[model samples]
Target: MASLAAGGVVIIGSKLIGGSWAMLFASGGFKVKHYDIEQEQIMNALENIRKELKRLEQADSLKGSLSAEQQPSLISGCSNITEAVEGAMHIQTLLPHQ
Candidate 1:
């Protein structure tokens, strides 16, 4: 398992950009929490993260020393923004495209 940093990371969105950020942090072995108001969006984002990581691994373009298989363990989905941001080393919020 990746030795997480003291505060870890929290992303306050579950869209494409948010998923990308989560992947980057997770690749660096930092635990990432995806915070979204909708549970279904969080679920979909998790699934997409898995798929994207696998694709990257297959293409020999995955980041970090850990395999795509190992990265998923570093990320989780959360509905409570307050709880998710608690002690988070980094917090990112993405605004919706208007």
Candidate 2:
């Protein structure tokens, strides 16, 4: 596993796009914090991201150099927006379409 970068990425909203961006960052050895207002939504996104990361690794389609196991370790769920953005190097927000 690659060493995660300090004050890594923060992805807000925890939707499909947010989850995708989090995975992308994690693959690049960044610790990603995924934030959503709802705890359940954050949890669901984390679970899906983990499963998808594993599947992508098996198919040899995962992005960057980090392995599936390593990527998930770098990604974490956050319900508090302030905490999620604290010390984050990059912040990306993705909200669902109406």
Candidate 3:
């Protein structure tokens, strides 16, 4: 099984994007750090993610190999961009092309 030791950074302008990325990475056993400019956006994004996840759970399409606890533990929110990127094996930016 893949381990969560593979750390990742997700820089997003919106919480919706950040949480989606975080959930997928967490399901795949990667530790994820999500960052945005505003904490309120982060909160909103996380809420959206949870709603989607509940739907996924009902449909059984989510990364189902992980336990409930494992999923939440794999993802974290970061206010510091530099700290979020530190020691990350990969970084993905979900921002406007401009």
Candidate 2 wrong stretches, greater than 4 Å: 1-5
Model 3 score (lDDT): 0.70
Better of 2 and 3 by lDDT: 2
Candidate 2 per-residue lDDT, tens place, 30-75, comes to 8889989889999999999999999998998989876788789989
Residue 85 displacement in candidate 2 (angstroms): 0.9
Please give the RMSD of candidate 3 to the true structure. Answer: 2.1
Cα lDDT of model 1 by residue, 1-98, tens digit = 35645668898888999999999988988899999988999999999999999999999999999889989988999898789988887889865867
Pull out the clashing pairs in model 3: none
Instruction: Using lDDT, give the best candidate's number.
Output: 1
Tell me the TM-score of each prediction against the true structure.
0.91, 0.89, 0.79
- lDDT score of residue 80 within candidate 1: 88
Stretches of model 1 off by over 4 angstroms after superposition: 1-3
Q: Evaluated with TM-score, which candidate comes out highest?
A: 1
The CA lDDT at 88 in model 2 is 81
- Summarize candidate 3's per-residue lDDT along 1-98 as a digit string, tens digits: 34546556465565556577778877777777777888777777666766676677777787758765567666677878888788988788787568
Model-by-model lDDT, in order? 0.89, 0.87, 0.70
Among residues 3 or more apart in sequence or in different chains, the pairs in candidate 2 whose N, CA or C atoms overlap within 3 Å are none
